[model samples]
Target: MTTLAGKTVVVTGVSKGIGAAVAAAMVAAGARVIGHYGRDRAGAETAVAGAADGQATLISADFHDMAAVDAFWDDCRAAAGGRIDTLVNNAGIMRQTGGIPDPIEDWDAVWSETMTVNVHAPARLLRHAVRDWLDAGKGGSIIGIGSWAATRGTSNPRAIAYAASKAAITAATKTVARNYADRGILAYVIAPGVVRTQMSVDSAEAVGGEAAVTAGLPMGEWVPPEDIGALCAFLAEGRARHLTGSTIDLNGAAYIR
Candidate 1:
């Protein structure tokens, strides 16, 4: 069985969705987790409550706000206790008015918000993780939570900003993977589509419903968060570390490229 026993992993956006599932899965696999959340204290606490004994810690930060984002890394550094084995960049946002197709000021604000939280925040956190790994002289991995939209544009033009932000960050992740592999820092991207999370369900509803979302896919079902969580656990083990710059698409056969 794959295991991360005695390792320390940082998973952001653990208040819910795939982030929460990853945190729980890593803790279950015997790794200590620092689960980051935005505002949901109870949800954050709940995400790690089932962790093995005391293997999880909940950290809070609003990725939308730069000040809080910076301070969060400070606190995460302290929580690392000098060594960090892995980091899962999972926190992201997609406003209903996310794109700037409309030249209006309101659409511009939405576009900015999506990029700030989805791309810029993760970049800041990645810098800190890379620095720590370099300082400790230990090999570690980074798991970036991307989306299928990063590779294939979404049907909803309103989410163009969200798609663009993810694509940019995924490319950055690949670059880091290639450039830093010799330095023992690895990066990988998992781009998923139509995940069975609250956000996905809400988005499906906005368009039609669960059935509408599933019917569009060949599998006729949504990819569960636990599946992504399990995949993350496997990659975090470093067994397939050579696949650092690869992008694993988990779209339930909705989009193949």
Candidate 2:
């Protein structure tokens, strides 16, 4: 029975998958949500449609573009009525064709795209959120969506860049928690092993197949995105401030460490 009533949460990548689920969960907790979608307006709309009017607002931004990332923060603040209680960094990209065996140029392109969308974009957004909270002298919460690939290397050789980007962001998230906890600003990382998102399914296909991936998992099923959504909502409540700087893993015991 976590309550986020009267809170404002900003969730990026609200178009689909974990982002959409997080937005829905936040709305369900009675928090006003400022949701960011890359390009899928319809998906974004569907995610928050369950909320009462004025409970959610959707903004579109291409995270690959730094300017858009900046604009997104401005727009998100405006949508939240100038105050955001929580920031959820959920948008990310995993290039499925960037292994060392690939052509040099292709590898470079994949790494660049993956890092820009996954690491750089979230870093920029974190900066904006932290600075704004400092200026307002109010505490805020950060929920960074990370991956198990960050801790245990991904089996998919093509996703080396993806793993690297996630690890980088995880470190950055911990840094934030260490530096800002005394100010009441809390930061956490959610490292999911293999959620049932399309992204994971696609990655499975690239490695071997869905069957192979599932067999390797301790649980016979993929981690549901709803679980992630629920955890995001719980963290947004800021109930467990001591959990700040912790990386909560939701891999169904597949890659526990």
Candidate 3:
């Protein structure tokens, strides 16, 4: 039982999927959440809805726009009353895009966009949180929502960029954990396999079918998004602080590296 009473957290991509689940779990754990979304206010609203403590606030932002990212952070700071204790960098985009044999321009566009939102956006938020925590003389946690691709490369050539981006964050997260552990700044990466999200369903369908994807996993089923959320809450607890800079795998025994 992780208790986060009075703690404030900012969760990205809360419009749906894992982000939404994470927000709900955080609220259940008694943490205030500043949920970020783009064009899905209804989804974000539901994510923060029914909180036991009434601490979930929704903010909108487009990751494609860097200025929007900055503005979103400003809004989060205000909403959180400058007391952000944890950042769940959960917002991400997985593109079933141009493959190795695709046109050069097609590959370039997908690669660039994937890197921008998946890597650059989260990296920016992590930097901001670190700076603010340093100035306030407080310790904080950064949870990176990476993928199993960050470790075992994906078979989908179309998602090459996605795997590469996740890999980048995994390494960057380890670096942050090494450098800031002394400062009580903990960083971790939750690398999950096929989660039960629309995005994962689509990706599975692209390969063949859900059954095919499931049979590949040792668990023979897709992972629930809340599992990641539960881990987020667990990691946020004081007891798990010593596991900083670790990459927690949630792939259901698919790849045991």
Best candidate (score: TM-score): 2
Total backbone collisions for each predicted model: 0, 0, 0
Q: How close to the true structure is residue 145 of candidate 3, measured as C-alpha lDDT? A: 93
Query: lDDT by residue for model 3 over 30-82, one digit each (tens)?
Result: 99889999899999989888685558888889998888888899999999888
Q: How many backbone clashes does candidate 2 have?
A: 0
Q: What are the per-residue Cα lDDT tens digits for candidate 1 across 153-246?
A: 8766677888899999998899889889999899999999999888787667657778877889898788989999999999999999788999
- Kindly indicate the candidate among 1 and 2 with the higher TM-score: 2
Ranking by lDDT: 2, 3, 1
Q: Give the CA lDDT, 0 to 100, for residue 27 in model 2.
A: 93
lDDT of each: 0.87, 0.93, 0.88
Residue 157, candidate 2: C-alpha displacement in angstroms: 0.7
Better by lDDT, candidate 3 or 1: 3
Q: Model 1: what TM-score?
A: 0.95
For 1-257, candidate 2 gives per-residue lDDT tens digits of 97899999999999899999999999999999999998899999999988998999999999889999999898988887899999999999887897999999999899989989999999999999999999999999999999999989999888899999999999999999999999999999999988988899889998789999999888799999989999999999988999999999999999877
Backbone clash total for model 3 is 0
